[model samples]
Target: MLDKLSLVVTAPEIVLLVMACVIALVDLGVKSRLRGLTYWLTLGTLAVVAFAAADMAMDGRTFYAFGRMVVSDPMGNWLKCFAAIAMMITLVYGRPYAADREMLRGGEMFTLALFALLGMFVMISASNFLVIYLGLELMTLSSYALVALRRDNEVATEAAMKYFVLGAMASGFLLYGMSMLYGATGSLDIDEVFAAIGSGRINHQVLVFGLVFIVAGLGFKLGAAPFHMWIPDVYHGAPTAITLMIGSAPELAAFAIAIRLLVEGMIPLAIDWQQMLMVLSVASLLVGNLAAIAQSNLKRMLAYSTIAQMGFVVLGLSAGVVNGTTANAQFAYSASMFYIVTYVLTTLGAFGIILLLAREGFESDEIADLAGLNQRSPLYAGIMAVCMFSLAGVPPLVGFYAKLLVLQALVASGQALYIGLAIFAVIASLIGAFYYLRVVKVMYFDSPITATTVSAPADVRAVLSLNGALVLILGILPGGLMALCAEAVVRTLAT
Candidate 1:
């Protein structure tokens, strides 16, 4: 039997695993096509898990369990809480959309989502290389299945195939990188790897070679440029609801693993990895913003926007260590965290409107589809406009502050190159803004395509309103969440 300390440390994972299984079994008995029973149970489970994670984060205790393969810390706990909430919101917005298309036939969506959240929990808590890989596989596998949930749809099936092929290749890159690190360091534990690399006895060439593959793998997961080939296709082809599921919450997990692998385990080689990140950031910004300008499909455009946003996150990460000094590590990493959280929040609302507009047989996935949206339903158009403005980094909205924080992190480094990078990022943002604002133009200025008023269920309506409000409210008063991020990062580094 496991000791009480281990159980307490892993309480959230235990709950998630058990409840996911129970929900799966309970869903077998669910007769409603909407799976109302399974849906409420999954929501209840997520709420409990979120509360537990938040409580743990507030407790401010760090524990290593399962032979130190896993850790429970404030940073991981906070991410878990946010991921759970993100999943909840995703389901709330997605269920109706999924049901309308008969994708809920087997009642697998709820169970698969629960399992995916469990994978995220594992990823956030991982302290060992093997554990991280395990978590990643679990999450990606569930996502592939979800992407293909509509078996009769060729587009979803094709998307699933592309996602699986690219995802598997990336995973191989990551695993091989881990193997190289283990061969050099003689340990799979993250802290042990740190100590081994810092001892200065290992072959620098091998470490750098391994670092290249590791960064490449992470870039793929983060949807950074060059390795972002799969994103546009997958996002455009997958069911919109599945697209949001794969796009949003999993990003938080990717951020967690990047911190674990690069910051915690490979900080001794910061100069090398930071340079790699800088190149990736610049490339991502250039490719993403430039390509997004030519896209007509809304989902494909958002997919490219995602790559550009990740460039900013990577830019903040690269600024964390300069001249072998980690003085700004907390601030830089916290800014990246803040940026990702806000990005996910805004993406949720943006996609929520898309899901809402999708009726029984309409896809509503074109920029032209949103023409004169303001005339159809002012509330949804207003929400989508808020999301678009936020994505464009317009002032008095969360995205503006998110960009400001990342750029501030870069400038705080006090290096000419980083300052130049900051300027370049500003240019990229300006170029990117055109596409985001284009959506607003279509919605408000263009002629209406249909006189039918857009409508959504009460839950989706209430949640979307709250989501839009939070984007604006958080921008006006950003200190609370900023402080929370700072504290979480500081505590994780302390341990």
Candidate 2:
């Protein structure tokens, strides 16, 4: 008999689960005029969860539960820590927006966020297909509800519907793939499937078909090309707070899921999937970058940027597995992980600035809205500039190092073509830079069309400042985080 109680070995997940239940109960029973209470409680819980995760990281134990459906290791631990911290930052950036719009009191937002975080924890640690599916659905359902929280808004409703339909399709694809894999290998566990593949017991045709569907499903989640149609509308239409969470947490979860699926489950067939990923990477890079150049809405542009970033991560994963060198592979994995971290920081910072500029009747989502921002508030302008520069992969910024590491890993693996493609990617990044810089130019050079005013809460200012500064600090002193990434990649590969 499986011991349900033995599943949680780390305090982080335990604390999160307990807090989630308590928050649900409180929301059910209590009604208070203190609209911000739920927000604070959510923030506090996530903060404690992050601290617990950090403590567990220091101890460094791998945990397994429910007959290996859940497996926790360094990589999962670190990603969970990132997720918690990101959630806390989202709360900080979002509180004022919610309050100003009179959308603050409902406990559903915070409760759903906690539930999503719990799902993320499970997603990262999932060692079997069933667990992965369960986690993915939990996160997806919560995200759908979150997008529709502003129920009266037509855009929010439309975006939520699109997200739901598309997300369900992706889930169906994943389920079909899992079923095929089970038919071929007679197992639901990733390790067992991999073993079957390695032992030559799996049918190659069935495996390939399964992998195709799986990649398609994951591609949808990562917002890569061909499956990226929903990104721009969703990002643009969703509430900025929900946008921040979707932009950051879910991307990290998808990356972790990709690592688990590709790195572990498909290792025996790396060559096959590597080629597929390369095609996806190239398509995403071209489509995402080129499409972003034409966007006027900052949020939509960022949505495309997310797509391009996923392409870069896919580039690393493709190179890592195709060349069949674990060291170089891990190096590439670390680069991808580092890139995701930097992207999260940059994206959140950028969105934080956007949320600050948004008023009840007006949303500052258009690039032109930022004109003469430097004249309005130099500090806010400066922070936005830093975010823009980081996203553009400017030198001495964290994004540059991220790209450099991926390129270096590709070169070390002797994938000259991929190196050239990465160089092309750099050029595309420069093209993407034009819009980012245009925002800066408008902020510093162009005069405002109307009187511009900045009104953000102190907590938002502090969190945004810290987020912007940390990107630069990590950019300058990237060795420490890079080392940690390397360690995480090693542990992931060892498992």
Candidate 3:
């Protein structure tokens, strides 16, 4: 049912899919050590797609294609652009690590990441339940393979298995919820579901039950508390490069789908879902920060930290309404979007430093692995410091502004409970800062474990430097990004 006109709305995805296939095929004729050819091609393709996404975002034109199953809008385009760029950075940072470990035997990493980006594109544009689920499956399937790419490693294999089982269960929950929603609303289109529920003629009990399952599934996907059992093991066990890939861009996709399913499809059920998200948020903050304090492994610590950051994102979502006014909807959702984008930006830098520290036969998963990093390379140490401090909500950094916006949105809701959630958020962030600061302390104060120079390839160092610069620059002038997010959210909600 796809046609030429459909391609216009999905041009970036179409181009990316074709290039991924081309890169894979081209890799077959190249020597093993020359895999950099495939890597460069992948990066080139992603750049083109990213530029296309940026163009679409600027256009701010909403166009529905494939019989309204999907739509291109500013919000989706911006997310796709960010996701593509994030994946590009992921690939750039991942290649040397992959090559060092002999995992670059093929173009599997690049192709799979491209396909995952395509999946994210689909998820962002999807306006139908089945389409969003299809995109989600594509992304998750690719990720599962990427995690297990180091097939010879026992830890990677075990992590892949755990990820598969849990991911499948989460998908099942989401699917079941979708089915119940379809039964109650008698439509699979997100807009139709919204209208049907807004009419207040539906079976309230069924809708509420479905909402519970959907929220649970989303929590698992976002690594929220109680459903976050898989993250620590998976992050710790998988290759650091793969962990970085998993951590960065996929989060943008997750945020897009959350907006699609919750804000777009089920706004009429906001009250029920808000309460559900509130519980998940509180639990995630408590579990993630407290548990992270006990972890020595950097990956596991960041994994738990991911859980806590997701709580803040969801907290913003939960505060979108107070007393059913819907007046704060735009500001609230935009704050969540800003938080997710900035969080992913900082995550890339954090994980990039980890990748930089990795060498042959050595995985830098331990907190102590960063000892004397500042003395070894102040440039990288400063980069890592920026990321860690940003995550800790330190002032004059992007993460601080992100957290501040969320808290402001919550407080502006003027509900005692929501205000209390803001206080809880502040307290949790304070408690969480210890681990983040501890990483910085190790980098700065701890004596060197190994005196080897922290060296990386030219491209890696250059791009990483730019990445770190963007984090600080954005923090210093967060207005442009905040405005973009606000505009995108407002445009999407208006349509």
Top-lDDT candidate index: 1
* All models, RMSD in angstroms: 0.8, 1.7, 0.9
Can you rank all candidates by TM-score, best first?
Answer: 1, 3, 2
Candidate 1 lDDT by residue in tens digits, 206-251: 9999999999999999999889999999999999999999999999
- At residue 242, what lDDT does model 1 achieve? 94
Candidate 1: give the clashing pairs. none
Candidate 1 residue spans exceeding 4 A from truth? none
Q: Which one wins by TM-score: 1 or 2?
A: 1
Question: What do the candidate models score in CA lDDT, each in turn?
Answer: 0.94, 0.84, 0.92
Regions of candidate 2 where Cα sits further than 4 Å from its true position: 1-7, 28-34
Worst ten in a row by lDDT for model 2:
1-10
Error of 3 at 5 (Å): 3.3
The best-first sequence of candidates by lDDT reads: 1, 3, 2
TM-score of 1: 0.99
